[model samples]
Target: MRTRRTRAATAGIGAAALAAAASGAVLPATSAAEPARQQPPPGCETDCEKVFDLSLPYDVRFTGWRDDSAPGGRSVLAYYIGDELHDSRELPDRGVQDAECGWDGDAQRCAVTYYTGAHSTGALSALLTADRGIEETDSVRGGAPGATLRQLDGNGRPDVALRQSTYDPNYADAPRYWETYLEFEGKFVRTGCGAPEQQPSPAPTEPLYGSCAYY
Candidate 1:
């Protein structure tokens, strides 16, 4: 819910009239109770906006399937760079999923594998298959939760996967976000951000210097 792959490299909505809401800001009554899983802290808007403005004008798609038909659930996220396989990573805290990455030609592709596993110690490992051949590494951990592994190009651009980690290593839920953006096909798209949502709560009228407006 935080960020669903940068769509169209850009992405807003209205206030009031809760029933007719479609923007990320609006949510059903039942969902309203579900506070955002996380968000950025005060004074992070500048950094957060850097990623948001970079990701503007991109397109995003989402898909999820149940590993089983029972009660709890798990999900997978596949991020595409202009229709090519940009990266595919799974949610860990949700249900202990695994992900792996590799390269093909000048492009990189990722495969997010899912299976039942133990909680272990805030981390888990998985096998990766790609042009680079097979390798295994810790795909998830405790402090950072679903942090992924990433690589960059000669220009210091995100050519491979983009890993998201806590802004502060000491706090798993700190107010900071980071991501990598790359040019796929023709246009450049940002792949991630720290806190991208604008909570539906009322905005401050006095405009205090320390007020928080980020997700």
Candidate 2:
């Protein structure tokens, strides 16, 4: 993950200029204009903080907050275009535990992870583009640790690989590890290509085709 630094500009005149003005000294006039200050969206006026920001290629920002006043402390993910709110989505969990954003080929992608309770976790993945705007591409409710991008098939584009776990009462001593692969065909769709139990390793070494059972 790359971290970009944002420089905040001071809005007022310099201390030396203020002192010179107070001393009744003539000062040279300047026509330079101050850079526009970025402001948070109206929805974030109360309690919100920007968790992620990307300035390259496009100006994208993610603002998140947990509404303590609301029941169960509802979580929100707000999308921004240079501080101006483009849209916002309500998260299924309480708050965002982690967030990641970067370019996936020509599209900009983001994944947000959150905990539902003490024992369970969930994730939300979003895709941003010029024509489609920002769209929620995928979501996992429980037992999702994280997501990664990979080339699982012959397609040149990258696919989304989600790591998940499930518990079976019959196999109480062992938890089953499962993976969900999503391919972008106009939009994101399940490929049904990953089965951790069937493979000798956690992930398949070769490209997967069709269904895991058949392949």
What's the TM-score of every candidate structure? 0.21, 0.51
lDDT of 1 by residue, 1-215 (tens): 22332223211211121223222232111111212332322222222211110110122221222233333434334333334333344343344333333222222223332333332212233222222222223332222222332334433112322223344433344443333333343222344443422222221211122222333
Highest lDDT: which candidate? 2
Q: Output the lDDT of residue 123, model 2.
A: 57
Residue 152 alpha-carbon offset, candidate 1, angstroms? 2.3
Query: Model 2, 1-215: lDDT tens per residue?
Result: 11122333223323443554456543221122222555544445566655444342334455555555545555666554554556566654356655655445455566565666544555567765544445776665544444444556544334444544444343333343445454453344555554435222454433444443421
Off by over 4 Å in 2: 1-38, 47-49, 63-71, 92-94, 98-109, 129-133, 144-159, 170-173, 186-188, 191-215
| Location of the lowest summed lDDT over 10 successive residues in candidate 1 | 49-58
Global fold similarity of model 1 (TM-score): 0.21
Given candidate 2, what's the lDDT at residue 59? 46
Give me the displacement of residue 42 in model 1, in angstroms.
47
